[model samples]
Target chain A: MQKNIAQGNLIPFVSVQQMVALIDSLGVEAFMTELAGYIEEDFKQWSLFDKSPRFASHSEVGVIELMPTSNGKAFSFKYVNGHPGNTRHGLQTVTAFGVLADVDTGYPVLLSEMTLLTALRTAATSALMAKYLAPEGADTMAMIGNGSQSEFQALAFKAMLGIRSLRLYDIEPAASRKLQRNLQDRGFDIVVCDSAQAAVEGARIITTCTADKRNATILTEQMVGSGVYINAIGGDCPGKTELDPLLLHRARVFVEYEPQTRIEGEIQQLAADFPVTEMWRVISGQADGRRAQDELLVFDGVGFAVEDFSALRYVYEKLSDNQGYDKLDMIADPDDPRDLFGMYLRLAPSRKGEAA
Target chain B: MQKNIAQGNLIPFVSVQQMVALIDSLGVEAFMTELAGYIEEDFKQWSLFDKSPRFASHSEVGVIELMPTSNGKAFSFKYVNGHPGNTRHGLQTVTAFGVLADVDTGYPVLLSEMTLLTALRTAATSALMAKYLAPEGADTMAMIGNGSQSEFQALAFKAMLGIRSLRLYDIEPAASRKLQRNLQDRGFDIVVCDSAQAAVEGARIITTCTADKRNATILTEQMVGSGVYINAIGGDCPGKTELDPLLLHRARVFVEYEPQTRIEGEIQQLAADFPVTEMWRVISGQADGRRAQDELLVFDGVGFAVEDFSALRYVYEKLSDNQGYDKLDMIADPDDPRDLFGMYLRLAPSRKGEAA
Candidate 1:
């Protein structure tokens, strides 16, 4: 049955089960570490990429966005939705899927469930940015809002930045416990804090990933100490923001894409002209990262298309030797390109027994 | 093995083979006729839909676009690519796939190969518009550029408007012969014309569905008679257009979406302020279609997201009783919505034997 599908029509599709199996095979931390490297490589040559602000369709409940980018060689886009109320109905607050296509032919080569991949890439990007912007010798991270992404963030930081200690806090203690339980045997010294204020006690790095659609300051001005690197992940849409504006004023903000970050990042609260460095420039050594030891730094990550592109590209390259992909008959490939109608006719029940 | 997968994780994926099978089972003309009804229903309630111009990424050779729209309940988007030069390499000039998601949950419910679906919907849309725009008792269609979409247009017009006579012409004589051969036994009088002039000689409806990426004058101003309804389908991207500008000036132009058609349709040659009636308005009876017998009508179809939405919705509804769809594990659904990490950990080799 599979042999009947032409080569051009078959796209490698990685399902959620396959993604889990693949991640388990490689180990989540190692997968993210490699994914981070792909991201860094792309960021180094970011000038070659075609970057556009994500196209978002907003509704009363949520927003669905399509983030597309290309580096002339490959094109990738992620279909993601953010509905904060989804968790209440036993659904994920955010779920995603993406496609990687060949730029030469505009043919999709891979389709993968990005719900898992998005978490991995977001964490990878946070850690990759921390490598440049975090205070030197940072060994502890204060993770606010320990939800689905907490363990991934913790592991990514551990893998990329050698952070062994974590202070976790969430509005619901069960969420923090869930994070702590998930990371318990993962070789980390964990502390479950009662409040956001208590979570940041001695940690040099602070990661806020609260999922609220409105502007609620997860970290205020007084909570953020000097020289502490803040990775703000959840304030990712128009009305959603995490850091206090004053905190943004005190910190040197870095973002994946300026135009997108201006609208979707924590810096959305700030002015249009508020100074922010594009992370690609810093990764490429064209700009500064951490200017001073006591300089407050914020990696305002709303998630960019390039990071997803990198993740998809990483998976596509790995699938050559990986066991977690299925060939999907997605593209229509008629023997005669102009004879699609003839191809349709040949698929009829009467014509099915005849040779092509 | 299928029982192990969660229900929320599975999306109904209609592949090319599946689409072909579904179309064949229903019969292409019947399927398109039903699809045309869906298109008309949506067009009637056009104000309820969220319409945005397609997000396109252009390469040197072609363009890849994402067309997204919603009607408050269901959201749909089509990922389509147009590479005119692809046929030279034995690939379709256009290939597409689309997804239909629930607006309330922001979870995808259907993923379908839209190369076949797109052809169907484009033809359906053309025919639907002609039902309103075409002259009374119009039976014959002069199909210039008899490529992949020619037979579809012919059958759709036949299914919807009783158009049984097709006058076909292509730059390549082989393409015209291929079209004629396919539709020969399908109960149509098909004329394989040598030139564009000969094709449109006496027909009341002139359909141009070429695959060039440039502004080609497939139909000159003098060739289009005063009483003809022109269905122009080829000029769908920036710098790609069909029909002479003077002919557009002479005709009362109707478009799928005015904003898109201004940039991509034959009207791209005209000023941005050039008058064109929105097809939805005509469908909804807010505007007149054919005011007089001799007044020229042009359905400047650049294709819109709503039409794809209608097609996807039609398929999704039909799949309830249809046999040609596979349950694909495309979305990640953890037992606990906030325990995605735990889900990943549980998938490990050590935890394989453990029961949930």
Candidate 2:
């Protein structure tokens, strides 16, 4: 699906299949390191982005969201959904796509499938959070959700934090086996644990990426050790939280965006006055990240638009080498500012012939 | 092209080409009538929507906006841009596209080009406003901007309001001539006037649908009479207004959403405390629209997301037989929730061979 139909214009799209291929080709470890770099670059000059809370529609069955962001030059938006019961019908619980457009022209430069990219970015964000929030010299992580995003999370920790070992646990044994098997040829060692307790027994960093979409305590207050960073990814919507309120009180919580976190992140379980820090401040060296080892920390990871912008940019850069057409004629070209009628003149005979 | 490859799924996107075809197929008059009906139905049940002011990013060249709305079940968002200078580069000055998605599943149900739809909906909105603002038996309209959208506006007035006569004016004679050419077969009594004053001479309804993204006063206080129903569609973004401040003071200004219109509509030039009524209130029969034949009324329409929702619904019904697809495998579907690794095995081997 690559075309170089136009000389100066190339609208490269990363489809779900292409994204999967990109991730599988590079392996998850390399993808995370590169993605984290992109995120870090954007976060350093974070104020330049026109950031707004995602517009969401919540129905009883699931939730749909639109997250958009712009840095004076380009605009990007992601369309995503979270339906927990989708797997029963052979559909993934969450699926997504996004668009990146030129701010000057408002023309979409890229349209990408973000389903796989979402997993990559989430893992990358977790690794970035661990760089600051996790205990010094953290080498191993307990992965609570050994499902769709488990592999990416495992490799991110391995590449970024030198986490040579992964203790994986899922509600279903097959999930743990699948994750353990995927890492068979990969460099990292994987341990299939029977329970959450077994997974976290000796792990320095605990990453809870479960998919229940409900308020469930995957990690109890006692199971958490001193200085461990918790990357809570699943409990992102209202009424969906992974940590016990007590655990949040003990840990210094960090969020992607505060307003969204208040409603969608694990912080939703806590009160309005719950103290939290934005991740960008820590990355930019403006705020205190970790005071001392053994201080509990939490990256209440509710995905943000900035992460999507980073992913769109990464995919656009990658696809440029392969080349794809601006095959999608997404806009009308009015030759004269006031003359839309002129556009129709050329369409007449040619279109009728094509239609026949 | 309308795709019907699949039996049940309809994929009749209003692509730039299809939009041009849509106009050419039914002519602009019929398009506007149906568009007005769509706008009216959504406005009638205004309480069902979760409405917010459009999210916008203004760069030096133009402004890009995302307008999102939902009615608990389905959510829709339109990505539109108003780059007034884009036409010089063989692109539309105002181009757009939007999507309708299931709120629960987050799957996009429709992705349609809105460049032509924007023209349709804007005209429909004006016609809808005329329904409430115009005095009974009003039949003549003065179309001030004879540009891209001028035909749609002209046709909407003719179809929706029984407006059979038009006094047309534009700085460029060619634009006015073009409008007359496309509209000749529709049988409206059209008079191409030399000036804006000449255009408004005896018309009962005055429409200013200009294209300039500046504060150009296309309509002044001296031109408009007491009883004229004014459709102010051009003055949408900040610094882009068509009506003079004096004319706004004299007229019973009506708006789609007062808070939004105050910032983006003709009312932007008026005082903060200026008296105005939301057109929805009038549609809901809660407010008095026209006090007498001599009372002035202005419908300030800056496009809304609900209208896009209505358009999506209308297009779905119109092209229920069309079908097309790109089977995006973005989400990981594991037979068992925990067996996500199996998907990697299934996808990777096949993909790598293809990559090689």
Candidate 3:
């Protein structure tokens, strides 16, 4: 349903159905590549952003967070929840939505369901970082924990870096089969492995994205070979770490935002004073990324808000050509801002018999 | 404009149009009075809540904030912006919307436009405080700053306190005239005064709700009488206050939450060690509200998140009988949860030609 444009209260909203349509219409591969470009561009200009760590409300089972950031011209925030047990009840472990607003007027311009968009952006960001930090001429990736995000990661790497090979592993074998089936005709040389070690064999890049809330060692130091790039994504909050501490000790770490990664990333397992480089510096040619040929590197990603800001910005731009969005009468634009009460009073007679 | 409910992905949304209709259908006075009951009840059980100071991002002309709270059962947050310059552009000075989610599942149950609801709840909270702190038989209220929130405050005081007389004043005479026109035939003896002092001449309760973003003293120490309840509503954020420092020093201050009020309320002008009482204690009969008939009292309302939570709760309950809402297809409720990618892939065929 659409609201009157003249009212100037309409906010364009992209729903899950519309998001899926948007992704399919653009095609997953092309969309991820374009999203990666936007992510890289935002990273290059990261100094212009007003960045802050996400504000989280932790519960016994999970957490819900508000991640907000802006670049003076536009403001965006993502409302996301992480409930690892949600998948057990036939729900996604992570579900999200975001809003993009005009910073000048403090008014929201776009609201979009970010569950699918988050998955796309997460993979796009990982690949964008890999483009700079990954091993030279890397053509194969080992995806450990083949859950909901596995397919997107596989496709993003393929689209962005021409990586046409995937070795998949999951604690639950059914999850591995699901990932394999989803990527069947997507032009990838796929292999289903029995263990994380087996998945990492003959692969130059290892991506770990488990859903466990505890500090579990999905990848040990011995399993991670040198000259490889590790995309550690699962250990996002405190008490959640995917890679062993010894592995991080031997690797040169890169992070999206240092302050947040120290608390919410795999680096949380290390000392507070542990060294890490911000990826924006490398992207902007302000710092060196990879020094040695066989030096191990880790991208400790906790999903920063700027990436979501870029994703929302991309969706807002796409609205001009996309029909998969609806207008929401979200803001109250009264004829006279002070006569807000009168707006209701005048509508009282017409709506008198409508209330049940 | 409602979506199919059987999908289990629908989130009920009440827009500004629907919210106005809902308030008018419920009858404004009755709605405000009932909302006050909810606010009082929530205050009585305040210890059961998880409260936090609002996280605000301030800009040159405005501030955007996310206020979140939970009761271990239901979680809610409000996305609101305060831009004093917005009125010049024909927009609301303060605009808002909120979401209510299940604590266990972390799924949003309802999303509603909160510009009108905020006006209603703020007035309800003020009136609730006045009911506890005002002198006995206080019928006349001097409403200084007759803006968007002024009429609601007047109506709420009339409904809750049986105050049948109102003396209104504003810097802009047109705003006072608008308020007077809106409140005519509402069973009140309305008097539009020329200045703030003339408005508060014989009133026992003085409400100052101006929208200036600076520390402008709307009420001076000399203008206030010895025994009067001050409803200070406008000076919420830092560098923005409506009352003179001497006035706060003379009045016994009461706050919704002490820590938050110390930074955002008029009390921000005073020393950090200044004593203030939380209103819940008075509502719970744990502390005295108004000490003496001749003693001054101030309800420094910064507008906490719990009131928004209560307002959202009220709207959620009313959704059962109200059709003035739409279902938002927000959550991506995949059947297997892990097959989120497959769900989108299947829709690809149907959305073949939709991409431009």
Candidate 4:
């Protein structure tokens, strides 16, 4: 009876506004730090997850995708869209929302806006991977294509790895300026660089997050230095990548899920049989992470469903103390499950009164 | 500018309470009739749509599924779960929600509670198939399962095909009693029968919607009469079917989508190479329906995503006059397409004030 009462017809929904409030209340740096913990834990148990490459419906302009993964007890999926042309229309290039459901009863428990959460989780995953793949004592990061994701990446590194310096660069000068302005009071010593080459100079961690859909060389082989880690996030989806094929050939590559990364990540540029280590294997201690401090590690990140599942589980866990969500009457709950028709008929009179 | 304004970050959500209100305002019979028309229209243009077998995540207890389909202009996916044991926990055996998005933009235009809509669409689909496959002047339906979907099926037949009598039977007699009580004033002459054999004694349309996760014979070879349209609904997943294989062998089987029906519909009990007509071809006048007056016709209904798309599109159209929906701030919309961090920072202060 208690389970039934708790599992009422309502689902808890956290909107974009609530997501911003949650981050603001927790403070951005602290929130990213806590988020990295969840991502790290899920990565440690990565073998337990049911993973799949996202299902995508594509058009000339962009794609709408559903990324679903489950850890036996809980299932989560993110509905996300990406339109490079959307920027011209005053919209974010990407927007998303996600759901967490109970695997036991196959009922949804939480639904939340994931655009902001994605930024947070992507940053967290980047930093969590850096903790394993980046060279020891690497504090300065070169963030190329300083667009929407630049500040989160900056803050996540600062919180998770004590990265005290950020050198940012964007093709458009205005984007780098905006990144600097946003991270002004966030306690990072930020440097606005003239080009991607200038941004990577003297930095051990180089993050390339350009949003172009073309196969451009954001980071050529000559630009990547020995012992430096390359966090490649923009080369997601086929026909889009950041690092040069030569850089991938020279560096020891790591990935989220090899089967998916082969198709969507920067590794898409590599041969079908190209060798890559699954990051989960490293996190689970089933495989070695960095063979040497100067091994030239490449984390070809395209993002994965398990990270979203971890984020949703974290939000579901945190909702108990946060009142930033609203209850939605999303499920039809009749007193007798067999009498769904009777329930509708019973509500007819009341609806008529309201209409009148 | 108008396009940008119209494509705002808000998604319209029709909740369960609003769904019932919308149905009540329209009258259930009238609503089902209108819904059938939309389904028929979509089926006519079925060749223009992208179709795939639904993606399902299975568990010991039940399954959660994502059904996605798209036309060149619009896309839709339904998140649904089916748990036969849920009734014991006071939950509907099935609950669903769906999203419709612009194929050009990948942004969700509408989010609707699909539990009620699913029932409506499923019933409408059954009647729509019957219109093409049922024998002429068939006015009696033997509804073998009298649970959640029975009344909608009964009423759909009444409104669409002028079915004036219903021969109802269920393993649990109380379910049949509830169905009879609900249809008391719906202008149908209903008879409660003791067995599946007794129920189809004098009916032209026999619908079996029993919900069990195993192979069970709700209809045997001798029970199915000549010239009856069998709407099989319950055998919607792997290893779950209702009718005897002999009936399928003798009947001219019709299906929504051949690939999906082969795995989830009653056809799963038949041979992998069993012949089945695609229903859309018949609706479009490309195939024959009811080949002979005495020929057995089986419309193996496992449900498909296009029906949900049609239902969501219909609901999106009807929402213009109905104020029964809530606007969800489900998408992250930042002023500068590349300035997601700046947008969160801008909202940070307002959220802080609300939290305080």
| Chain B TM-score, all predictions listed | 0.95, 0.89, 0.94, 0.95
Candidate 4 ranges beyond 4 A from true positions: A1-6, A349-356, B1-7, B350-356
**C-alpha lDDT of residue B181 in model 2:** 82
- Kindly provide the TM-score of model 1 when superposed on the true structure, using C-alpha atoms: 0.94
lDDT of 2 by residue, A24-56 (tens): 677667877998999988888799998888876
Residue-by-residue lDDT tens digits, candidate 1, B316-350: 88775335688888888888888898888777665
Q: Pick the winner on DockQ between candidates 2 and 4.
A: 4
lDDT for model 3, on a 0 to 1 scale?
0.86
lDDT leader: 1
Position A216, candidate 4: lDDT? 92
Can you give the TM-score per candidate against the true fold? 0.94, 0.89, 0.94, 0.96
Q: What is the per-residue lDDT of model 4 for residues B220-243, given as tens digits with 9 covering 90 to 100? A: 998877878899998887788999
RMSD in angstroms, all models? 3.4, 4.1, 3.6, 2.8
Residue B234 miss distance in model 1 (angstroms): 2.9
Better of 1 and 2 by TM-score: 1
Q: Across residues A34-103, which tens digit of lDDT does each residue of candidate 1 receive?
A: 9999999999989889888788778889888888999988889999988878878888777899998887
lDDT of each: 0.88, 0.78, 0.86, 0.87
Worst 10 residues of 4 chain A by lDDT: A1-10
Docking tier of model 1: it is medium
Pull out the clashing pairs in model 2.
Answer: A3-A324, A175-B338, A227-A294, A236-A264, B3-B323, B4-B323
lDDT of 2 by residue, B1-356 (tens): 12222221222244666656656676667877887887787788888888888888888888888888888767888988878777567766677888877665556766777777777888888888898889889888999989888877887888889999999998989889989986776779999999999999989999898777689989889988888888888887888999889988888888888888889889888889999888778888888988899888888888778888888766655653442223333344445545444555566644444321
Which residue pairs show collisions in model 1?
none
